[model samples]
Target: MKKTKTRLAAIAAVALSAVLACGVLAGCASDKGEQKASEQPEQTAAASLEGKSLNIYCGAGMTKPFQEIADAFKAQTGCEMNITFANAAQIQTQINTTQEGDFFIAGSADELKPVSDYVATSTDLVKHIPVLVVPADNPKGIQTVSDLVKCDTLLLGDPESTPIGKIAVKAMTDAGVMEQVKQSGSITTSTTAPQIAEALAKGEGDAAIVWKENAGKDGLTILENSGMEGYVKTVPSAELTCAADADAVKAFSEFLQSETAKNIWTKFGYELV
Candidate 1:
């Protein structure tokens, strides 16, 4: 009976040990399962954009602000950006031909009209104003569109390809001195407003009608703003139909409206729209 009781006690001990071991294993499994469940969504999100990149076709004038914005976006979202800068017309043409770009930023709304079919949505990002830019010392006494007639070399954007040039022509025409200015000043033209600004800074031309932001460069000063006709332009941004990742594209679009982007734009002499 002693042996029987001893054997019975041993059996009970074995049973209890087995039960404890099972419980411990189950507890460990439960903890591991909970950890995996929490990590799954994070892993999936990280995987989604692990190798993804976005393409943006932007206007040359917006390079400064957009580049800063792009850096901030990549740090926050872990997505990469490829940006192409050119005149609005050239970018629009590329959008039409390639059908591969993700976003388009035009210096003016008119630049978006021709490629309306490719643009899925648009928002006014900022206001652009065209101004007469001259060397730091207001040589030649240029103060208004009328005064452009006295410049030895007058630089402007290519009206056929750039918004600034088109607006410059209108302002000159409205000022009723388009013909006189052309005849008096040696007319020089560039493909983009920013280029014209550079030319004016280098003294390549005595005067250049460029965007107000461009005129903010160190060695340049605004002689006069081509009053409100061509000067009061809005910079518009659009998401094209060819966007591969709509969520990523939309996120960037929203970022453009964010306070961070607004600060950068303002720093670059752009007013939010």
Candidate 2:
């Protein structure tokens, strides 16, 4: 009887040891599984986008900032970006004709209207405010919107082909000064906001109405309280229907609103939406 009891006790001890070993092994495995799960998302994101490519239609005014954002995106995901920079209206026309872009980044939501059917998703990214820009030092003493009439030459974006141009007309009309502006000075129109800024830099006009961000360029100064506070436009980035890889497009669209992209935009003087 004593021998049998001793043998049973030994058997119980072995069984307990086996159970404890399994528990420890299971604990280790569980820890390893959790660690792997924690690491999976980032790895999966990079893997999914690696070697993918996207075609982007970006506004000409946003070129500098968007290029930086694109560089960051490519570095993170290993994706290639093929960007086409033009005025928002011109980009809209291109989208309608080609139907071959992955995304469209416009200066205003209005520019997206013509290509609405081709858009799968749209996200407002920044604010595009119109401001009166003049040569540094206020050479013409142009201090107000109404004062635009006193200028010898005025530069404006083409109302038919640029978002800034459309906003310029509407804002002035809302202020009841559009007719006066048109009648007083020789108005020169450009197809893009950058062109207007360039013209101003080259001393092509005494005053020019361009996007607020462009007013930061060298040799330009924004006129404070120029009465354009009410006419701000929202910049939008849209995913197009032509995106061959929806996953890749979605990833990039998300990146456009990421903190990194926001920093880039702000660095270029754009206001966050």
Candidate 3:
């Protein structure tokens, strides 16, 4: 009876070891299969692009719709999109200095001038107008473009590197208040419209000139006055002449001109151009 019991225990141990070995082998196979599956998208994307990738330098404000459009493009074509959003002027500067990038989306056509040599062509997509945004209480009594000269702390986009800033500077210059505002030591500068909006919301400045779409932020008020007229800036997407694959860039540009992309821009409150 003792010998019989010992033999039965030894057989049970062997059976358990075999089961554990099978489980380990199955797990290894499962992991390898998953890794291959995860690599499929990238493999497919590379094939779709014919091994070429697109690089985009986009304006900060256009990020929302551009992202939506990029995702749609990726899903349809399996091509990869590398997008970087920043001040449009800054983007142009980088593109010019590096002589790289496949496309440039500027806040305005004026911003694209710096990279004209690298841009084969471009299309105007939307319009964004400048507006004076103030705290809800209307502090400093700022009611018009003329009032900007009176604010103790007035914020605007960096005119040298921002499209809105250029427009704001031009408008203030036209109003003959640019010199006064600058001399008054009241002018503050930001890189983008969203930054200007944030400064207004934080009460960091008495007022800021920002895009109309950004005027609706809480704790801020859009000063509606005719003085803000003629400040319209248009958004344009340029196809770069330096692109490694012109066909791919052209296809993406065509997508931007589609009704689908137009709807995406409209959904973000941009006026279709």
Best of the candidates, lDDT? 2
In model 2, which regions exceed 4 Å deviation?
Answer: 1-37
Q: What is the TM-score of each candidate against the true structure?
A: 0.80, 0.85, 0.78
lDDT of 3 by residue, 126-238 (tens): 88778888899986888888888779998889988888888888888888898999999988899988888888898899988888877668899888873887888788888
What C-alpha lDDT does candidate 2 achieve relative to the native structure?
Answer: 0.87
Query: Which digits, one per residue and each the tens of the lDDT, describe model 1 over residues 1-273?
Result: 999999999999999999999999999999999999999987676446545688998889789888998888776667898999999788888989988888888888999998999989989988988888788887787878878888889999999999988998998889898999777747889998878888888878778888888887788988644353445988888889999997788778877888888898899998788
Write the candidate numbers in order of decreasing TM-score.
2, 1, 3
lDDT of each: 0.84, 0.87, 0.84
lDDT at 158, model 3: 90
Clashing residue pairs found in predicted model 2: none
- The better candidate by TM-score, 1 or 2, is 2
Please say which candidate is ahead in TM-score: 1 or 3: 1
User: Model 2, poorest ten-residue lDDT window?
Assistant: 143-152
Better of 2 and 3 by lDDT: 2
Error of 3 at 273 (Å): 1.1
